[model samples]
Target: MAAMATWFLIVIYLAFISLGLPDSLLGAAWPVMRPDLGAPLEAAGMLAMIVAGGTIVSSLASGRLIDKLGTGPITLISCLMTAAALLGFSFAPSLLWFALLAIPLGLGAGAVDAALNHYVATHYEAHHMSWLHCFWGVGATGGPLLISYFIKEHDSWRAGYTAVAIIQVALVTILLATLPLWKKVAAQRSMLRASSRPHHSDASVKGSNKFTAKTDREEDIRPSAQPMRLPGVKMSMLAFLFYCGVETLVGLWGASFLVGARGIPAETAAWWISLYYGGITIGRLITGFITLKVSNRILILVGPLISALGAVLLLLPLPGAITLAGFVLIGFGFAPVYPGLIHETPVRFGRANSAKLIGYQMAVAYTGTTFLPPLFGLLASQAGIGLFPVVSLLLIVLMLLCSEYVNRAIKRKYLIA
Candidate 1:
């Protein structure tokens, strides 16, 4: 059983890496793909928005899907969807094909993200959660470099999509082989649930399944059900919203800020941006160890404070080295907040309700990813890229405030210490 559990962890980590493989591919390949397809450069944003919209819709529906279909099928089908979309990208002849394909790509990515996050949050230790996300960072970083290589070697952006699709297909095969593993785990959890509620009759379990299936929909997604009436749910959603906005704004615009505002060369700025993501990966590694000595709340508080300090550093009239240090610090500071919030969800809202809350949280987070950075882009266009630091600072402040409210709400309503 222990060995099986370890293998489960390994497969999950691999899945996470697969999840990230295509995340940044569009951005990296757009320079080449756009010219070949005869699309305007700005058209990339439309495609991105289309993908984000699909992700938002899928994530919002994931609670019901994951509850009914289970994680194994959800992960399997999501990866297959992503594989199909990537294959579509590889052969797309025009912008219309790319736009249409973005929908499934987004849906697959969002469902996989929400399902895996909820799974790890419920079943694993915080350290494993941290490490799992680090693996995602590994894939996110590798995708661009891999795509860039393909574009360089073959002078064809299609090769990048083809290579990633092959990798995703390989992952889907592994997932297929691991079906029994997921089944075993589900069986164990069901048994535990039955034993824990020995007094409940079959009717109760049936009712629970029905209730959970509709929780996200009736309470959150549907118009009649007041999800905000649920304790801690609204705060969690808003906190995730701000957190994602802070992270995305920095990632998407950091290089441009360095190049345009600080007068750093584009090549050097890109290198520093890589270091920023490296900081996030490394920080999560360190955080996995630090979880032994600290609580999730402390990590959440300390992280944003450190990130705020980094934002302040960027705001200062400093040398290039200091600015680079600021970027790294910001990344490091952001490392723990996401996983920490996720791991705390079950504790904050009973396990019975966590699935719905997590689904809503993911939807809100993706929505933040979709719209907030674009708003910042408009700001940068009007106010200059130097607005990066100020905008980051503002987002960080909002994140911290949201975290505080969430913490207080959980403590007051849920009594979660």
Candidate 2:
């Protein structure tokens, strides 16, 4: 059983890497694809928004779908959908076709993201959670390099996406083979719940059996009796919103900011942007080790504080080297936030309610991802890309404030173990 669990986790880690594969491809490939497809450079914002909108919609519905269909099937179907969308990108004739393809891509991404996050939070250790996201960072870092290489070699962005689609198709085949693993986990959880049911302290009838057939069937059909109607959940969502906004804004436009504001060469700017993601990948690797000794609460608080220092570095009137250092710091600072918050979900809320709460969190996060970066694009168009740092600083401050409020709320209202 232990070996099976380990193998299951290995598959999940690979799935996470696949998840990150397509995420940064657009941002890296866009500068080249934009002119080729007759798109204004700013139009990337619209593409991002479209993708975010699709993610938001899918995330909002994932709880119900997962409840009905289970994680294994949802993951398999989402991967296939995403693969199809990537194929669409490879063959797209214009920007409109790209926009149209983003729908299924977003839908696929959100479902897989929510399903896997909730699954890991409930079943895995904090270090596993951190490492899973670290793997995602690895894929995110790889994506741009792949696109950059293909563009340099073939002068065609389509080649980059086509390669990604092929990878996704391969992953889908792996997922299909592993379907039984998800079912095994589900069955084990069900039996555990059954074995513990009769021991409920509040049972009214002495020597009563809570693991009746009817009870088992009911639980299998619907796990949570009540929705996660909690007070601190709203603040948590707001914090996620700001964090997603900050991360997306940085990833999507960081290269543009370097080129337009600092007069960095395009090749050098792309390298720096990849370096920024590399910082995230490396930082998460460190974060996974840190989790062995540090409490997640303290780590969560520390991440944004570090991020603030990075934002200040960006605002400083310094050399391009300093600015590059600022981005690296920012990426490192953000490393622990997303996964850290998620790892705490089952602790903050009971396991029964976690799926629903996480779904809502995913939706709000994507909403921010959908709108904030494009808004930054518009601001940069008018006020110069210098506004990038200012906007980033403000968002980081807001994220920090929200985290503080959430920490306070959770401590005051609930006992977290």
Question: Which digits, one per residue and each the tens of the lDDT, describe model 1 over residues 320-402?
Answer: 89998998899899988888787666445545555666667777888888888767776666777778899899888888888
Q: Candidate 2: what lDDT?
A: 0.78
Q: How big is the positional error of residue 168 in model 1, measured in Å on the Cα after superposition?
A: 1.8
Model 2 — which ten-residue stretch has the worst lDDT?
200-209
Scored by TM-score, the top model is: 2
Scored by lDDT, model 1 comes in at: 0.75
For model 2, the stretches where C-alpha displacement exceeds 4 angstroms are 188-231, 346-355, 410-417
**Each model's lDDT:** 0.75, 0.78
Q: What does candidate 2's lDDT look like per residue over 281-393, in tens digits? A: 99899888877666566777888888788879888889988888888888898998888777565455544566667677777888889999988888777788888888998
Pairing residues by index, what is the TM-score of model 1? 0.80
Candidate 1 has which clashing residue pairs, if any? Answer: none
